[model samples]
Target: MFLTVTLNAALDITYRVPRLRAHSTHRVQEVDERPGGKGVNVARVLAALGKDVTVTGFAGGATGAALRNLLAADQRERPNHARLTDAFVPISGTTRRTVAVVDASSGDTTQLNEPGPAISPAEWQAFTTAYAGLLPRTTAVALCGSLPPGVPVGAYAELVRAARAADVPVLLDTSGEALRRGIAARPDLVKPNGDELAQLTGVTVPLRAARDARRRGAAAVVASLGAEGLLAATADGAWRAAPPQTIAGNPTGAGDSAVAGLLSGLADGLDWPARLSRAVALSAATVAAPAAGEFDPSTYAAVLDRVEVAPQPHAA
Candidate 1:
């Protein structure tokens, strides 16, 4: 089973509007609410792909309760996708929420996110204790999303070390200091977007940045370059995977879907080229889905072969 960790879980809210303006009143045509956060989003995509996945993190208050309810609802609605289990740590504070405003006219999406609640020392201990118990069962663990207010910046590093000690493959999919420290822990894989890669390694080029990140103790680095596709650097080799064409929709959780693809492929022992093809195809299909963390099934099957995986110019 794959495990996804989200320290700051959230209720994802997506709003559909005719058009978005800088400062104007507009009525939203529709709204979608789902359990979200980086790890939760990754788990959602993994489950949709028929992977047995468990999501663990912080959840509390009414929002947290509602999020769990929605997760249960998802299991009931799609039993064949995969089994999604909730193992979140309960906190006294309310979980956070993220808002995505999509302009149907231009097919553009705007996001407004709130910083999650600050966790307590006791809460952290409780989470770590439970996390230790879950490590052995995880084939691969995804340490995803932002660190909550009270959590340490080195939280992901701690988790990575624990997973390493257990000989379990772990993937770090966070940004900022968490990512920097997590990379130092020598995870099996690190998936970062171009900007995050640049920020961590100070390299402007995606390929060079991914290589630099790999040098910083990560076994491999997959840099997500939005529509340009994924640039991956591994011990085996480096490759750039791109979709046939950019499908415009909601790119909200495209990165998460890519993570799902990579983890699933890794579990299946697929080569880097095949793995990246799945990542790029899943990302493009996610863009075609109307909501964040969901992929269009038909779009994914059609785009699978169109994804192009080519070697990086400087890397053999």
Candidate 2:
């Protein structure tokens, strides 16, 4: 089973406004609230793809309860698919809420994320214990998202160590100090967007510079290039997976969907090229959908044939 760890869980709230203008009173046409955090998003995608996935990390307070309830409802709604293993640990603080304002006219989204709850030392201990207990059952672990208050920057690195101890591969996805520290743990895979990749490597070049990041410790690096698709580099070789064309829709969670595709491919024993193709296809499908992280299976299948994967030279 795939295990996903979201250190800072959240209740994601998305609002649709006709035309978003700063400091203007706008009427929201639509609003949606769901369990969120990068790992949770990945798990949802994996589950939708008929994979057995379990999500674990820190959750607490009323918001946390609501998040769990929403997950339970989703599971019940899709009983024929994979199930969520009970692994989430409850803390004393309430989970965070992130707001995304989607402009209807232009389809652009502006995100406002909360700092998340302050985790106590005791809560951290519980979270760690929960994660350790599930390591044996996990075929692969995805450590995602930012570190909450009171959580150290190296928190993901510690989880990577636990996954390594259990002989399970880990996929680390985050940014800033968390990404910097997590890479030091030498995760099996790390997915960062072009901007985040540049931030981590301190180089403005695209795929060429991404290779430099892989040499630092990540066994492989999958850099998301938005409309251009993904650039992946591993010890064996490097490849670029680009979609046939760009589709206009919500771009939110596209990277997370790509991570899910990569993890699903890895769990299924797919080769690097095929994995990159799947990641590209899924991400494109997600962008074609109206909701964030939601992808149409038909669109994904159609895009699969169009994704181009070609080898790239290793940086000297």
Candidate 3:
């Protein structure tokens, strides 16, 4: 089973507008809400793909309750799919909410995110306890998203250690100081977008720079290059995976869906090339969907054959 850890849970709200103009009033055609946060997104995608997944993290206040209710609803909606294991822990602070405004004409998205609630030390302890109890059953642990206020930057590092102690591989996806500290723990995998990769490795946007990041401590690095697809470096070798072409749709949560594909592939004992293919397929499929963090299974299957994986000579 895969264990997904989200430090800051959220209710993601998305609105679709005809065209987004600065300081201009626009009529929204659609508005939707879902349980979100990076790890939760990963779990949701994995569950949709028939993987045994569990989500653990903080939830509090009315927003937290709503997020939990949404997850429960998802479970009920897909009872035949893999079940969510018990790992969600409650805390004192209310969870956060994120908003995305998508321009229908341009397919561009502007996002606003809350910093999330400040977690207490006691709440941290409760989360740690719950994580420890779940590690034994986890085949892989994915630590995702931003850290809440009052949570130390090294929190992901601590979770990495716990997963290590339980003989479980860990994947970390975050940005800024949290990512900087988390990488020091040397998690098995780290997925960062081009900008985040540049920030972490202090290199310009290039494949060589991403490879340098792997040398810095990431056992393997998967850099999401927007429409360019994924650039990956692993102990086995370096490779690039790209879809046939970019698809137009909502781009929100595509990275998280890619994480789910990566973890699911690893759990299924897929080779690096195969894993890359799955990741690329899932990411592109996500972009073809109208909802954030969701992909049509049919679209995913159709794109799987179109994903191209080629070796990088410099990756070694």
TM-scores, all models, native as reference: 0.96, 0.96, 0.95
Over the stretch 1-316, how does candidate 2's per-residue lDDT look in tens digits?
9999998989898999999999889988999998899999999999888889999888888889989998999888888768876478888889999999988898788999989999888888888888888888888989988999999878988888888888999999999999998898899999999999999999888776678788778999999999988998898888899998887777778999999999999989999999999999999889888678788788899999889888887576
Worst lDDT 10-window in candidate 1: 307-316
* Model 2 weakest lDDT span, ten residues long: 80-89
Please give, for residues 56-162, the per-residue lDDT of candidate 1 as tens digits.
99999999999999999999999788999999999999999999998999877899998999899999999999999999899999999999999988899999999
Q: What are the runs in model 3 whose C-alpha is more than 4 Å off?
A: 17-29, 104-106
lDDT of each residue in 1-316, candidate 3, tens digit only: 8899998989898889999999989888999889999999999888888888999999889999889999998899988778876367888789999989988898788999988999999889889999999999889989999999988889998999888888898999999999888888888999999999998888985588778877778899999888888999898988999999878877778899899989988889999999999999999999998677788788899999889999888643
lDDT of each: 0.92, 0.89, 0.89
Q: Residue 208 lDDT in model 2? A: 68
Q: Would you list the rank order by TM-score, best first? A: 2, 1, 3
- Residue pairs with backbone atoms closer than 3 Å in model 3 (clashes): none
- What lDDT is reached at residue 256 by model 3? 93
Model 2, residue 295: what's the lDDT? 85
